[model samples]
Target: MARPAVTLDNYDDVYRYYLDHRQNLLSARIAYAALSARFRPRVHYADGARERLQALLASGTRLIVVANHLTDRDQYTLAATAWQTPLRSVIGRTRVLAKDELFTDPRLRRAIDLMGSIPVFRSQNHGLRAVADAGRRMMDVSAQRLQRGDVLAIFPEGTCNDGDPRRIQRLNTGVGHIAVKARKLGAPPALLALGIAYGPDPSVRGSADVYVGDPVLELPTTPMDITRAVAEQLQAAVDDVRAVR
Candidate 1:
């Protein structure tokens, strides 16, 4: 049988479906292998970041990983680079928030599902009024997943930054809301800012620079405040990658 389509109207059902779904290890390995073979980006880490990340994971603390959005292939490079870093441990345990359209293609959807991706109905794609309820539900689901010990990875900028690859775009407050909600649910996730910088021509392989920042254990209480703090930290990470590249 064909899988039921994911839509805003049926978001609650889809969310429930994800809650019961488990990532296939074999599928995840195959997907990561493909990503690694195609994108050979160099990975860089901030001072003490490597040790801190391992400690956090060892303590069972979930991560809310936020990264800059660059080209369409940014996620591929990010995943490939992550496989070469301490992040490899959470490959199948992380739930990535990806736009809804990406799940529309059957061939690509299988890989996304295997990678533990949750469909996000963005306001830009569905209109603010249309996505309001579904957006709130999505945030709730994300928080619940964190509480369940799943690492949450989000591209908070919501869209690719075409104007400047080195600078991070304004982040949406959704990530902040998700963090705050998860904390209120008794699951405070550590924040990890990952920065990705592509060379002048992003289309070329091996021109990506991926930087991982030290995890932020404590975040601001309010959503806007958390968003602002995340933006500042993300910009610093981006600068670090640009400096080395």
Candidate 2:
């Protein structure tokens, strides 16, 4: 009845899987980093999160950077923001929770695999039970990674929405569930709330900011209240960052 608590050893197979595909991961990390630099993405952040995150990283805080999934540009935005710290958003360095669709394509698959993205299946019009099951699966992965002190990033909104950062799309409650599960385990990594959007001039290169807000809610959020709490806190981080204009 203990749910067979997730552990780093439980993820040894995944690590082996990654090791077998190491070259592809290396290639992807290089390409994405090159693309980021070639485009010269700019950042305009206001929160102490930049420093706080660096400190957390240095202090061994496993960070779960929740970003706003926007255009392809959002990835670059994260790269630039990450540059401010010792940790760069190099694909192979951390795990990303991405949609299952991205894993199916061949050409794109290699790159995504290299980017350290774990595919997550999201069924449209599925019942909440199915959704919750899928979320727990993801949590197993997240929990395993956190147990090893690896950073994980996910887009809680579940899709790209290139709109006002303050006016975000509805977020699926899965991320909240993961946070809750992690907290319950008492060793879950820090799920720092981050808001990434088109700086001010996203159309042009090097002209926007990736705003990161305060940690809205610490991990181990009340299990009963977690699903809603993660969404509300993450949304608040976005709205609060956007309001700084």
RMSD of each: 1.5, 6.3
Quality of model 2 by C-alpha lDDT = 0.59
TM-scores of the candidates are: 0.96, 0.74
List model 1 lDDT by residue over 51-150, tens digit each: 9998998899978999999878877887787677777888888888999999889888887888888999989888999998888888999999999988
Q: Judging by lDDT against the true structure, name the best candidate.
A: 1
Q: After superposition, which runs of candidate 2 have C-alpha atoms over 4 Å from their true positions? A: 1-29, 89-91, 125-133, 162-165, 184-186, 199-203, 227-229, 240-245
Best by TM-score: 1
Tell me which residue pairs clash in candidate 2: 25-114, 44-209, 183-220, 199-208, 199-209
CA deviation > 4 Å runs, candidate 1: none
**Residue clash pairs of candidate 1:** none
lDDT of 2 by residue, 1-245 (tens): 11111223233443335322333555655666676676664444445766766677777666677777767666556655555544564345577776655655677766666566665656563445555555566676675666566677777777778566566677776666666556556655566656554555667776554556655435545654654555666676666556653
Number of clashes in model 1? Answer: 0
